[model samples]
Target: MFFRFLFAVPVIALFCLPASAGQYDAQFRQFLKSDVAPAARQAGVSQATLDRELKGLTPDTSLPGLVGPGGKGKPPKINFQAEFKSPARYFRDSQFNALVPRGRSLMKQHASALSRIEAKYGVPRRIILAIWARESGYGSAKIPYDAIRVLATQAFMGQRPEFFKGELIAGLKILQNGDVSRTGMKSSWGGAMGQPQFLPSSFLKYAVDFDGDGKRNIWSSDVDTMASIAHYLSAHGWVKGRDWGYEVFLPENVSCTREGPDNRQAISAFVREGVRRVSGKPFPANEVNQPGNILLPAGRYGPAFIATENFYVIKDYNESDAYALFVGHLADRYGSNKGFAGKWKPMKETTRGAVRNLQQRLEGLGHDVGGADGLIGFKTRRSIGRDQEKNGFFATCWVG
Candidate 1:
């Protein structure tokens, strides 16, 4: 039986701290005792569990914004052009293709266990394999940080406290259940653990024991790991037969601003606006009724995708649109297509600090570039391009 809980906290009274340098080990301990301990107790976590998992565990001050002295002076900037243009850097087609045979072999290795899981739950095998390959490189990758320390840091010092606080408690429960040792509860910076990179809260809800060991162990057990991934997607409304989405050609006159998910005009509406599917194929009956949004991931230069409801489902797993595109494209590479056909434009690769400085400078000049968030989303890029045009820079009107 899978136990799922959705603990939604309103985004009110949450304090945002600037990235500061200092060791908060004492403060962190105080936070655990005063704030986290009571909350964990209310959520039914035993005192024994808290001591076993969190006692003597120091906070990881090396997290993104919490780096100590001798580290780089400013937060790292995102180099958009370099990231996108060099396929080897980010999108390695050949290396990704090589994983297909390995993925198939692993799928076959766990076939019996996966078969039992599929019988009980209607989730498909390929989708499970796709998620497995995309996250942690089919279980070959190692999760790097201590889960509790990472969660606590994010909760106390990082941006989203309420969300991370719930996850922090969920992680303690995983330790209490004896599924993982406190020492072995390693995970990503954001506290996503094990083979499928599940956030601790997500693991408690969606993890399953396919090996029948009476414990849902996702760290080392392939059977349990893959089944847990399958269960997660199935719970989150994954339709088996439908493609995640498709690469399509928009008409020359179709405004690129209408491409974001927010402006998801109905397919029929887009069709009326001279937008045609790139494949020259008729829309599937179920999909035509479903609204599709345009995504210009790299502004006007790169490939455009008409994302379906499933795309949002993928985003639920990882919020970044670029990450979703990478996963979807990686899956496509393994299954069918070689690569996207769109021509990419070159843009300056600015570091996170540089982008923030640029945004501040542009805003000072009344360009209305969104707040100095390091992420170079479409709005930021457009604002940058407009400023560049005014400043007499070689304006291709692209944002990095």
Candidate 2:
């Protein structure tokens, strides 16, 4: 179910196989009493809360990405031979077509609440709506797991147990605070709880009660859900008036290898280099002096952009350039509903293993492939473009 949540973003964990409960039930319960209980106590969770929440709890081995009871090994890899994708396919027009109309209607229905959120957080209504639309289909997507159960199981055996341990404690604290009932505190398998899909830690830090019902019911209240999303983005530094990014035409002489956040310069610097908005409009005067970077997700093979810090702010929500782009572009669609002006030229679909191999090879050649993690991040794409330029081939800045 958590894997299903990423349909609108990076598919981070691809564990499709159901987990089966093994022989560790007794030891897992021991772990909760000795390891988790003290932490929850220190975090101000009551004994009653712990007694009620942990009773009858057993490890849900059917959940994906868990290790053995000792939690010493890496979680098993997603079964290999699953299809890998090109970044181009991530921007399919059909995905946008299905979502835009639904999002527009939600905007009108939640218009008043959205206005208050923007005024409070300085994040615009459309951006907030886009995040809500993506996270849980404007609160319609069914979240299928109990948050405490999911967090406890992951803390017991899932990958990154220490991180989940902290989140597990936070979930206990959420229960102690009376925000939601045991049944209502639902989550995706990864423990991103409720409509905004916040991890328990995030829920504790940023989830807000906008409707003033004396409880923050992000699970069913549209107002709380919208406010929470805006709060997360604003806390991560969403710029008030700036758009996330703009599609632009990068002139031939301007190097594609300049694409990344580390290489940011004033937008005017790009204008001087002949990068123009595809709309032929001048760069906004306020934007010209601010920092931006060249963004070519599929290199020269697809749309180009001059992305602002706000774009990176979206990435803070989920650390993928593609994820942020989907949110930003989808937000734009609720207004005029147009697709990218640049086309995604067809390319071979390659696996993460292949991409990691290419990254390793690039590293051997004295290039920074951004640690060879098997994702074609901006660094990897630019490194590929640099290599292509050295070979006297036109740099597509992509895996051709």
Candidate 3:
């Protein structure tokens, strides 16, 4: 299971309107009236609702897209030295530290809401708070694009129409409910909205008015936002009191692999396969019996983690291993652990191109590293590390 912060267009670009603003706005308005309205009507949205939501809306041409002017070129191929050496590659310690106080404050402020959610849903308040802090910086950050325009653009662009179309309808429903003004319904370019950064469909399904003011106002309502996050996690199988899994030390000569949940042997089977507990802290036998899959996100240079059901539950919020690890680690920190026992090996900067090359090279050698997408995800990183060990390149197999 992958988990990480939901992807966002860089916050800096959020306010930068596109150069073709007028033309795109005109085109978008026409598209909405001609296409989106019809689609919404077909989806059971009332004409009155559609009229209120779609009228006066304009396209945000500033949103990032593949091959667009603002799009960066594909990231460089993986090279162990460059990624580690680059100052920008790793998470900034200072930034993370700064976020802690704010995170703690929000945790306290929303303590009651969190406690109530935990009692109802069986997910920890700290974990929910961690997600809240990470997603929108405790509700201070603004989502800069109009939800409808972004969804319409993504749907019309045809990359993920089936998914975005559903999101669009849900967004219209949000507007129809009068919970937010159409003008105030700004969202991430990918269509995630408000503090918990939910896509419209997710908001519709999980958002709640915890304060009971009769609106699920995720944008400005702290109670509603935090509760919505808890609800989402609960719906996704978050088990209260169960650790999301711990860091482990691999024994020598172990056949360590990053397998997906479906392909993984039972936790008992893997325990018998010689996986050993590395945390030094003892766990209950039942907890050990819970199935997990290993993930080496930053190749072998970074720490490895065994993801549990709760990890996948976090992934239901976002689908990146880096993201899941961050949330899990943050949760661990907020709950009282500093970090993993093993230290990440130092390496150079890893560019998108290098990551793609690493995947291509690994796949060519008969290891399925998923596609040669520039993202150096767990599968690709693990395959590379294993291959590196086999080839005597380096046991750590740090990537750049």
Q: By TM-score, who's the top model here? A: 2
Q: In model 3, which regions exceed 4 Å deviation?
A: 1-21, 66-90, 153-165, 258-279, 284-286, 337-340, 389-400
List TM-scores for all candidates, in order.
Answer: 0.73, 0.94, 0.81
1 or 3: which has the higher TM-score?
Answer: 3
Write one digit per residue (lDDT tens) for candidate 1, span 17-42: 34345456777788888889999999
Off by over 4 Å in 2: 1-22, 79-84
Q: In model 3, which range of ten residues has the least summed lDDT?
A: 1-10
Q: How many residue-pair clashes does candidate 2 contain?
A: 2
The candidates, ranked best first by TM-score, are: 2, 3, 1
By summed lDDT, which 10 consecutive residues of candidate 2 come out lowest?
1-10
Kindly list the per-residue Cα lDDT of model 2 for residues 232-285, writing each as its tens digit.
Answer: 999989889898999999999998999999999999989999999988889888
Candidates' C-alpha lDDT = 0.68, 0.84, 0.67
Backbone atom clashes (below 3 Å) for every candidate? 4, 2, 29
Model 1 earns a TM-score of 0.73
- How much does candidate 2 score in TM-score? 0.94
